[model samples]
Target: MAAAAPALTRSRRPRLGALERRNLRWGLLFISPWLFGFLALSVFPILYTFFLSFTRYSGIRPPVIIGLTNYERIATDPLFWKSAYNTLFYTALAVPIGVLMAMILAVAMNQKLREVGIYRAILYLPSILPVFAISLIFIYLLNPAYGMVNALLGLAGLPSPNWLGDPTYARISLVLIAQLGAGQWALVFLAGLRGIPIELYESAEIDGAGAWTKFRRITLPLMTPVILYDIIIGLSLGLQVFTSAFILTGGGGGRGGGAGPDNALLTYVYYLYKQAFQFGQMGYAAALSVVLFVVSLVLAGAVFRWARGWVFYEAEDA
Candidate 1:
């Protein structure tokens, strides 16, 4: 009976028509450009970088194999350690602060108003500006003596430190720069906020929940997935922080020699750029890139695992 059933199932299975086979071929042909790009631009470069990490190559000469030397050098380097620490500290401070600010702005923007679109546009404008332009504007704005930021602080009877120049304030200044671009994140959060059922808020109100209670019990719990997404995005961007730091620190001409005072602003990506371009250490740079890729992968996996408990889904409940 089992042998008969197997034969029956095989007889009943449908085979592809000639038209279907033609359609499949055309579909693959249509997407071949993307497939080629994926192989050539993405996959090939990644594999090549991994291969380069084990060899000495200064762009002009043929790569000479030197297994594990670059990795060993990275393990012992103080500047590498400093850059890693700075990158982590920046991500820790910036991601949470950026998430909180974006959430607040999103909640406020979610409210119904006569001219809400105007307010939203104004808020989102900064996020769309070129980073170089923004960095330059902030460089002048944060000038210690006569910049608008210092002048405003002085008016409030607060001392203003040299933002880009002082080692103590440089990273914090970068965090502030991150905040200025919160509009895009806020928009994502706003979409999440809208997706949340209004019935949840109404139910909380029926239970005599106040604003804080409703926010804690209803709003925040539902927003965890959005927060998780934002955190991941922030972490990826923050850990590879370069452009603003590079511009503000005067590119290759800063007090700490491409690093801000005392190497305080020398982020991981900036240090990698220095190694590969400035110092002609391509193999070492490739090792650093690989390390960064591994660390990011681990951090992302940890976050996803941790989120299993908190991130609620309507589909899961259904």
Candidate 2:
């Protein structure tokens, strides 16, 4: 029985060959570099920044140990509130309008019509334009007197509001321009729209459905996933809007370069940029970044939650 027990054990348990074990180890080893890089670059930096947020550090010098002073200051800071308000305003305005416009353009581009390529090209060109250069062009276009926009307004006997210069219009100008250059988003929507099968639309048409009814029942429901995707992206980008605000609000290198007019166009990221690079308050900026991180996480989670009910993923069709 004892001799048979040893034979049974040997038969039941077979050790991996040295070469196979070596290959397994090497597989893990290959991924270890990526894991290490992710830890150092992605994870550690995030932790370090969160720690720094509680301290005070000018970019030129070492951090001074402080306990929640920056957070406390930000809690009561009017400029912080102003920036938050402007960011929220931008997010609110840009998300729905931009998404709707993008979807509209995408649907138009998806039609089997002549010159569709030209239409698509023209629509997407603005997205690739240098943002700063686009802002410069818009600056001249929105100029009070000599601008073409105002000139058209004058010809129509309408009042021309100063776009970048006026407090009332400053934030709206950013929102408007963001909407205007939604070409990239349009392309994304176009891709999603094209992915929808023609059979469903044909079936709806065969059922004697009207154009509006067919769209409402087939197009919109199936497109909900893409719509939700656009919402998440638009919210995140709009909340962090910087380039348009930076150009309109006088660049972020000095205190004078705060938001335009009454700080109407100041976004969360623009404020954070001003704090870190311009004011050299790296700690406060880190704290702001942390806040932004939390807010973004929350927003993303909310979108996912809402999408669970609203969005019709491809898997749902199966």
Please identify model 2 stretches exceeding 4 Å from their true place: 1-37, 252-257, 316-318
Q: Write the per-residue lDDT of candidate 2 for residues 274-312, one digit (tens) a residue.
A: 888887889999999888889999989998997898787
Candidate 1, run of 10 with poorest lDDT: 1-10
Model 2 TM-score relative to the real fold: 0.87
Superposed on all Cα atoms, model 2 deviates from the true structure by an RMSD in Å of 6.2
lDDT for 232 in candidate 2 is 88
Q: Give the Cα lDDT of each candidate.
A: 0.87, 0.83
- Give the local distance difference test score of model 2: 0.83
Residue 190 lDDT (model 2) = 88
Q: In angstroms, what RMSD does candidate 1 have relative to the true structure?
A: 4.5
| C-alpha RMSD of each candidate structure in angstroms | 4.5, 6.2
